[model samples]
Target: MLPQPSGPLRLAVGGLTSITDDFAFFTYNLCDYRRTGRSDEARYARVEEVIRELVRPGTPTVGAVQELPGDDWTSAAHGLGHLASATGLHCQAFTDGTRSAAAVPGGHDCLGLGLLWSAEVDPIADTLRYISGGPLWHALVMVDLNVGGHRISAASYHAPPKAGRDRRTAEAGLVATTLRSHAGDGGEIWLGADWNSPSSRTTDGLYYDPDPTEMVTSADRQRWGDDLPEIGYRTDRTPDMIMADAGFRDAAVEYGAPWAPTTGHGPNDRNGPRRIDRILYRPAAAAPGGVA
Candidate 1:
């Protein structure tokens, strides 16, 4: 179950001296370094290079990252610290959601979730919260930030890759509901995630129409069973739909690049190509031109 807010939480104020309305948000699924052939140093350097290329100087930026190399909090913090140094951003690692206690090695908690933000953003005191129960496959880290004097609720999430549609839908529902509760009416919210599912609706074949045979395999069928398609692997867009129904907008689609692929690059192309990683946001209803 998601934690409920006890009362009106006070918003943190006035720490940023160079606050700006222009905010740049990004999400990335850094595949577990242990599974790849690249050395830790090489992988870290590549990640830093990619992020630096993506970030625009002088703009407030927030990056939500998944699959950070770490089995425990100490290791994850160390990894996040390296990223912070490389990217010049403040960092925080989400506790491993796969575990009932503090983040420790030896389960599905090997890969972790994290958040990185530029100095222009101020995180509210006691606002950092994690989703408990529902046994989320990966962590969902949520925090409230004072961005240019506007209170915004932001989160980083990574949905289960091997779970069934029902499980994924439930997880998405949990995330949406929890975010809405934290944001309240007319508040802005941002979520960056690797949903491990397609963004296109089943009925819509215009955007993404990958050959199911190339994506799904016998192993997938044996694992997911009835949750998969009768012939091949297909991710029903129910998870993304849940976010849409909650009033969040897919940032890529909104920016006119709905078909841009975020995954299945290089050696990780076993599942073909997909736009699974995303940055979704809900603008404040009362804001004058709205915040993205």
Candidate 2:
């Protein structure tokens, strides 16, 4: 179930067909510890501070948030509302990723995905849609927005974690197909996701080095059998490659040469540092629209 905005003020659509100035699009995985009796206020405050520091003042921003607290609609709404108020952003939609938890053996119990946008943009009526069709570990929630007057579709996705390379690649194909269908020929599309897999374009040699102790350990092989690869976890680039083949470009890669690691800084770091989180976009300039 998706949660409705409590009370968000929206602007009437009227502006140029394309944006001349810069805007911000950010993706974050707000590790779902709050559901396990952690303090929500402290976590929300820290997240708000990080967002404020990253997003420039007066810039229209859109955020794709993964791992909201709780699996139920009520808890998801509460978390979304709290974050929206804290960041002064409008709650667009929330999709419960744990709806099929009972069906998945040993799957996570509580996980949700959400989207938030600044007041400058208005959500296109009835454009919100959730992508499904495969064994997706988390929700791939998308919505069309009228940014000033330029329309674009954005999605928040989280690929399955741990020893699911085939599943991840399959899910990536589903995502790419869905985005291409929605965007059509000229529509712009933005996707922010914690892919849980290293990029195909990674120049970093550390990711390629075989380390047996990291993600796929002896215990993991014993449990899941010998089908798992030996080259550590998240080393497979097939998932990211699927996305690249669909015409999407990685934001971090386009911004510079060396990609910065987005995860493994926490105290519970297990897989070592890697740039698993990404913001990918399919420009409209590739088709009919002149804007990118």
* lDDT string, candidate 1, 110-212, tens digits: 6766777878766666567775224676678777776666677878788877643457888888899988888777787888888877664332444342433
Residue 281 of model 1 has an lDDT of 80
Where does candidate 1 stray beyond 4 Å? 1-21, 33-38, 92-109, 132-134, 163-166, 201-231, 287-292
Give TM-scores for every candidate, taking all chains together and pairing residue i with residue i: 0.75, 0.74
User: On a 0 to 1 TM-score scale, where does candidate 1 land against the true structure?
Assistant: 0.75
Compared with the true structure, all predictions reach lDDT values of 0.61, 0.61
Colliding pairs, model 1: none
- The alpha-carbon RMSD values of the candidates against the true structure, listed in the order shown, are 9.6, 9.7
C-alpha lDDT (0 to 100) for residue 84 of candidate 2:
76
